[model samples]
Target: MRDLEAGLVDAATGHAIVATDADGVVVVFSRGAEILLGYPCDEVLGSHVARLFDEAELGSVLAAGDLDTDAPARREWTLRGRDGVPVPAEVVVTRRPGVGGVPAGHLFVATDLTERRQAEQLQDELIGKLGHDLRSPLTSVLGYAQLLDDDTLTDEQRGYVNAIERNGRRLLHLINELQTGTGRSRSAWRGRRIRRR
Candidate 1:
């Protein structure tokens, strides 16, 4: 059983898995946790898990109060590292049972969100650029189509001009939708960042 547990811990690449007694004392600190937070198991195993985060940051986790054994809770927060660096992380906590099937400890699995946030920012930037490039030509096309209505033209020419105006408006609408979607995504990102502060 010990060997199986050890293997599980070893396999937790890029994921921080920690176990703490019901009293909040750390008992299992996996290698992935060390890599993520820069603390070795020997140093953290006997310490309280709260020591890894700021006093204020615990609000999201503690708000749930005492959890029933087997019940899992999740939250996102900025975790402070041994080096005093803050890492944006999402943690899932599950209550573990002891010999008598009573709640004895808690297990935590945390994933770092730094890379994911960076990727989102990059995607937003790219989308913004694409929207800008598309709108410029669309604006010109719409303007020209609108001006054509003021000129004298044959019936067939009027029909062609109307088609141009209609398609131009449609293209402009599509671009606006793209920009609106990107703006909403950026707003959500900002909201999450503000909550973490």
Candidate 2:
């Protein structure tokens, strides 16, 4: 039996805890486990952890040599919940050290990353907006500089103009990449719509 008070304290810290046998049968499933995996103890206990996995991504996940074997294993895997929704989860599995410092049953902890996806989307939007706002001035500066010729300008003026053109062109390159995420020459630009959003 689990110590409910201690388990609750652990749950408050955000790690979902479980214990399983070597063959993968779940033994102890805590509330944190319930929230993270989205299957209650009654349903998950005595069940294989593999049941929580998406069958398709499993082979590659195992082949990656990514399992932690240090009395406990730690890994990240995209797991499917009872609702059949795929979620990114961080997992840690450790064996309880026994008399000879050998493992008893496996102990597992999982953390769900629902908030992380939101943060990444917000970051991408900010970068895309910053890139879009800087594009117009850079285009104008490059346009004016390209119109100048060496015969009409002093050496220092030519050098300054060249620097301006180079920086503007670089800025344009970065903005295009941010907007479309692909490199396309001006000839290709006419037919393709940039994926700015």
Candidate 3:
């Protein structure tokens, strides 16, 4: 039984697990918490768990009732590392129960969000670059196609120009949707609409 208990404790230590009493005094700090926060377990074990967060954000979290709920609640928090720098963290808080069905404490599980945020930002930048590079050349193609809609063209030539104009409009619509996330592209431009310009 002791070995099984120790194994469970070891598993918890792999995550940034923290347990605090009802009044918010820290009761347990895990090894993963120490590594992530850069704080020694001794420095935080008996202190208030508030040391992990900025006062203003902590107040907001308290007001949001994220710390105590019948079920686990997850929210983003900027926790203070031992170096005094803010760490972007996503924390899940749940109630810890004691023997005899009494309320024991709160348990917190935290994960760093820095890498995920960075990846999302990078994706946005790449999308912007693709939109710019692609649309510039497409604009020139569209401008020249519009110039070809003159009456001097033969019937076969006019048919070719109509095809070009229709395809170009569809491409532009697709590009617009890509950047703006609007729904599906509208139907291809009508012949009269193309001839008007």
Q: Which candidate is the best by TM-score?
A: 1
lDDT of 1 at 50: 92
Tens-place lDDT per residue, model 1, 21-81, is 9898999998889999998789998899898776786864477573453667777768778
Alpha-carbon deviation at 3 in model 1, angstroms: 2.0
TM-score of 3: 0.77
Mind giving the per-residue lDDT tens digits that candidate 2 earns over 1-197?
Answer: 34775557455547677777767687777777777767877999888877877776667756864443564566776778789898787777676555676555667677887787778677668767877678777777788899984688999999888888877776687677756657754334444553422
Off by over 4 Å in 1: 66-69, 154-156, 182-197
Q: Could you give the candidate ranking by TM-score, starting with the highest?
A: 1, 3, 2
List TM-score per model, in order.
Answer: 0.79, 0.70, 0.77
The list of candidate 3 runs beyond 4 A from truth reads: 1-14, 152-197
Q: What is the lDDT of residue 108 in candidate 1?
A: 85
Q: How far is candidate 2 from the true structure (C-alpha RMSD, Å)?
A: 8.1
Query: How do the residues 1-197 of candidate 3 rate in per-residue lDDT, one tens digit apiece?
Result: 96785467557754688889978899878778888899998999889999998889999878987666668888888889999988888998898887886768898889888787788677667666887888989888888989998999999998888888888787777668756757732223112242332
Q: What is model 1's C-alpha RMSD? A: 7.5
**TM-score: the better of candidates 1 and 2:** 1
Task: Give the clash count for each candidate.
Answer: 0, 5, 0
The TM-score that candidate 1 achieves is 0.79
